[model samples]
Target: MLQTESEINMFNASLKGKLENLSLSSFRDLTILNLSNNALHGTIPSHIGSLTKLGILDLSMNQFFGALPLLLGNLKKLTTIYIYEIGIAGTIPQVIGYLKNLLDLVLSNNFLTSSISLTIGNLTKLTSLYIHKNNISSSIPQEMELGNLKNLIDLHVSSNLLTGSIPPTIGNLTKLTSLYIHRNSISGSIPQEMGHLTNLIDLAMSYNLLSGSIPSTLGNLTKLTTLHMGENKVSSFILQELVSSNLQTSLIPPTIGNLTKLTSLYIHRNNISGSIPHEMGHLKNLT
Candidate 1:
């Protein structure tokens, strides 16, 4: 068996032809492929789908164009796929659902559009995902589609045009550490379900349209370090209005004192009322 399937790193080679002669049948045992920072141009070959043994594929900082190859989903063992700033346009293929073993998926700073598909929920093993800074417009899809990514850790999908509410099911990502969905058009109350992310460290959802009282559930995140939830309508004005109107929801549950690890906290621009509990002094780590 050809042992060529071990590691093929051609990062920043300035190679041209845009994958024209990039054939892989001979390298059936291939595992890692890094072609980042190159001059490669043209459509990704469909034959790429046949590389079932590939684990890491990095094609970032290239000039590749056209829609992402659907055949990419064929690589079932893929652990990481970085396609950042590749000039590739088109919606993320639903076939990516096949990568049950994928760990990281980065496709940021491109011209790509469309919303994340529900099929992404199948990547239950995903850890780090960075698909922000793209034109992927529209609200994030419902939790019924991607609430199963329980192993997710760092999710940075900021700087997009994403609308809609933060899905409560996101609490299912109990292992999350850094969650950055800021600078979007997301509206509505911050999901109390978010409190379940006990492992979370950094939570940045600022500059959005989120409302309602900050749920004390967040205090449950004992590991939290950075919390940015500003520029929303969650102030006491809205809170009092919501309470007087008896529209929906409750108040901060004093349980917030549990986040002893928190260092940076940004809760301005909201309608949050009530006096700061003395328990807040227990946060000796607060900065």
Candidate 2:
């Protein structure tokens, strides 16, 4: 229970029972509230919206139900929100764009449905956005405003029902180091613009309808250590222009030999033909 004039600005506990009785609203000065991994049941109390000073709110791994309240926009200072795996259903609210200070949004493994809100483009400061393993059934935004998140370093939207080809504008996220969009219904060829992500370390796009040959631009990602593009419609002649080796007629381009840092490469379950290039010997780090 909150005491009068309590100086506890941050609250984290496994307490059970409805949140309304906690009178969280009275703790006007609260900055962080975490009630995750508890037996707490009931809708997230609207009083949480009153905690304007809050910077982080975590209510994941509980029994909470119902949609996220639109009042959440009132928490203008919030930077991080973790509400995954609590069984919350409904589309992410459009008002969420109001949280200009938000830097991380983790809503994976939920029942969230429908398309992603275009308003998300307003959050230019976001660095990590994880919405994978959900029921979201929409094609990746074709306008590709997500490229506006210049600070984005991690983006995961795998294990959903997404479709459509990757937008060439995705190259605009030059700061990305990890990108995962596997296990979806996404089709079409890999965008040459993908070569722009030179900082990528992990790229997974398997178990989808992706077709066409692997873009040689991927060779530009010298920092990449993990690349999984299996179970797709990709053909032979992968990465033909990836290196200066200029070796042609090989199924797996010798240019692949240039990725010395590659540790895990999963290019199975495809229509690939010809012999595995001997150049693979260069990947001494492969495990």
> Best by TM-score, which number?
2
Model 2: colliding residue pairs:
none
lDDT value, candidate 1, whole model: 0.77
lDDT (0 to 1) per candidate: 0.77, 0.79
lDDT of 2 by residue, 1-287 (tens): 23234233223455688766778888898777777777787887777889889887888888777788898999999999888888887888988888989999998888888988878888888998999988888888765467777788999999988988888888989999999998999999889999999999888887888877668788798888887776676653767233111112346767888888888765543445588789989989988
Q: Per-residue lDDT of 1-287 in model 1, one digit per residue for the tens?
A: 11244778888676777685777656677798888888888987888878789999898998888988888988988999999998888898888877888999999998889988778888888998899999888677677665888888889999998999999889888888999998899999888898888888888887788777667566566777777666655543222011222223334435556767767654433445566667667668866
lDDT for 16 (candidate 1): 79
Task: Kindly give the stretch of ten consecutive residues in candidate 2 with the minimal lDDT sum.
Answer: 240-249
RMSD of each: 4.8, 4.1
Best by lDDT: 2
In angstroms, the error of model 2 at 101 is 1.0
